[model samples]
Target: MFKKEITAGAKSKVKSSVQRGIRTKVVETYPLLAPHIDEIIPKKSQLDLLKLPDRVSLYALNNEPLFWQHMDDAIVPHLRVVHQFPHCFSRIGIDRGAIRFVLSGAALMVPGLTSAGGQLPEPEGQLKEGDVAVIMAEGKEEACMVGQLKMGTEDMKEKKKGVAIDGGHCLGDGLWKMSID
Candidate 1:
């Protein structure tokens, strides 16, 4: 949603109850996040909520963005969060050639993910549509973007064309450029 560089909004401390709720929701949506829940959203740590354009809500810890949600859509982790705990999220990789496009904030295409250099979850359909995914580039150690799947991995393997993910938060996007602190 953050297609352009946007300025920071006021940061407010989230209530303890709300923090607990967010923690619960995150863990529920991403069960793999359970093990690191305490570290990601420590019970004692205060969380900051920042309002961004297009009805997005960003949750940060000590000025480091942990997660963001659009309207009432499923909450997705920030790229920083994905980098901090890479294995905790479902990830797909694009070929080296697609790295620049992804970094520039273009929506992911199936070919970029189905190519020889790309990597998708094994057995296909392991990751379904509407699920949030981390986009890693070939040979890269960290993810370059995070976005919800427009089509299931199974569908992508079948169609081998069309968009894979839309509205992804990428490495150099406005969200990444925004200085939370």
Candidate 2:
């Protein structure tokens, strides 16, 4: 969703109760993050909220972006968060050819995931539409982007065309370049 180099509107300290709610919701959405939850968001730590354009709210700690949610939808972790706990999230890799486009903030295409250089969950049916996933590249060791799947893996295998991930935060997108300070 953070395509352009947008500006952060406000920075406010999140209330303890609200912070607890966000922490719970984040763990619920990403259960694998449970073990490192404390390290990711300490119980007594103060979290800050950065309001971005388009109703996107970014949660940060120690001037580092942690998680963000658009409206009341799923709370997606930042790429940095995913990188730190790479094994804790569902991942899909794109071909080398797709890397540039993804870094440029383009909608990920199906072929990028179905191609020989790409890699998806072993079974085409493992993932469903709207699932949040980390976008990895063919030769990269770290995730390049985080986004919600526009279509299921099964559908992508069958159709082999069209958008796979829409409006994701990429490695070089505005959000990635944005500083919490």
Top-scoring candidate (TM-score): 2
Model 2, global lDDT = 0.90
Query: What is the Å distance of residue 165 in model 1 from its true position?
Result: 0.8
- What tens digits encode model 1's per-residue C-alpha lDDT throughout 73-180? 889999888988999899898999999988887888999999999999887437888999999999989899899999999888899999998887999899998997
The worst-scoring run of ten residues by lDDT in candidate 1 lies at: 120-129
Please list the residue runs of candidate 1 whose C-alpha ends up more than 4 Å from where it truly belongs after superposition: none
Cα-based TM-score, every candidate: 0.95, 0.96
Cα lDDT of all candidates, in order? Answer: 0.90, 0.90
Q: Which stretches of candidate 2 lie over 4 Å from their true place?
A: none
Task: For model 2, state the Cα shift of residue 142 in Å.
Answer: 0.9
Task: Give lDDT tens digits, candidate 2, residues 94-135.
Answer: 999999999888999999999999888867436889889998
lDDT of 2 at 152: 91
Compared with the true structure, model 1 gives a TM-score of 0.95
